[model samples]
Target: MRSDTAALTTITLPEIRLRVRDAHKLRGYFGELFREHSPLLHNHYEDGTFRQQYPLVQYKVLDGTPTLVGLGEGAALLVELFLRIRELDIDGRHYPVQAKHIEHRTEAIGPVAGLRRYRFETLWMPLNQDNHRQYQTQSAAEQQAQLTRILTNNMLALLKAVGAYASDMPLLLVHLLPGEPVVTQFKNQSMLGFMGEFVANIALPDGVGLGKSVARGFGAVRRVD
Candidate 1:
């Protein structure tokens, strides 16, 4: 594997924060806004500039308020494109929202921590492996192996997304909180396993996400330690 051990020039990412009113149950809110304003978002990108290297525009609802996190330096442009709205229509529900910006906290974020250890917790949704049903019929040891594979796949994707392809990343230890299965909005008309209360201890960067539907805030991970 190749590695870029050179120091990365720090880039300050600005989050497009928003406060929503009268929306207690916002399952697919983020997906809706981007879908509704696809053109407005698309206009900002030059041809072939918007590759999915960790979602240049990451969307999430924090503290019951929706936010669009600009992963790139040019991400703040999204705020200008949508901030003029008094309200946004997400998943057929009109939510009154206030939009603004704030710098993402990055002081303690890194792929390798001081102790080579990190603890991650889900913000809104859970860490879904998409292998929930397989676990039901497996032995305890087999289940653990399956779970680790799922988490490892997730972490590997994150590392690749950020161009971190150094060797030995696969040896990293990962533990996941048992996710309960429930119906989610992704399939719309079908019920599937939706992970809840996901937590992990792995050597990875802070603020990176895992599992399925990360673009719509399904598996949000943050540093807890």
Candidate 2:
């Protein structure tokens, strides 16, 4: 891989620190998604920059469940996969995974206690328009089955980029901005956006926030073993 691309491919755990008027509110917010995704030790601030080694997409969960609106470029593909999974028209046979999936893996630790530990991966699944249309026509059972297959394949690809044991499972969070968000790209940094002067950034050092060297080392070992 090119140095830059290799750099980009590296996965890092996110660091977040949350401050709130009521600690229970904070726990309630994360507890909503605890069964499916994990929250690691991250810095908290009413307003400040998230510390990262690379530029990645960051979401501020003003609410518990992350909707699709929370994703930036760093998280777009994963969120897109989630959207595809949810677009299923059938009932009962939704994607085998649900919002509660991460909650099952949640744990309470020290100061950073009461959150889950999670891993993340990304995949690029190129599909033709014909398959897309066919996907739309399938029965709920068939559609969910297809989604399971597709999700598994995509997650495998994500593992190739990151690792197999990064997170317990995959979850999608969305943005709930009242209106359109303004996005700005930079020459040496991550993407930034604004929704009515409230800023949201998609920078790197993502995936539960591990450093580049450590991520690469883990990936290398996984590849060889």
Clashes of 1: 0
**C-alpha lDDT score of every prediction, in listed order:** 0.45, 0.26
Q: Report the number of the highest-TM-score candidate.
A: 1
What tens-digit string does per-residue lDDT give for candidate 1 at 54-126? 4444555555555544433324445445445356565465655544444443232224423343333333332
TM-score of 1: 0.58
Q: Which lDDT tens digits does candidate 2 get at residues 46-135? A: 244433322232222222222211112334333323332222111222323232111111111111112222222211121234554676
TM-score of each: 0.58, 0.23
After aligning candidate 1 to the native by TM-score, how far in Å is the CA of 63 from where it should be? 2.3
Error of 2 at 148 (Å): 0.6
Q: Cα deviation of 12 in candidate 2 (Å)?
A: 16
Q: What is the lDDT of residue 216 in candidate 1?
A: 49
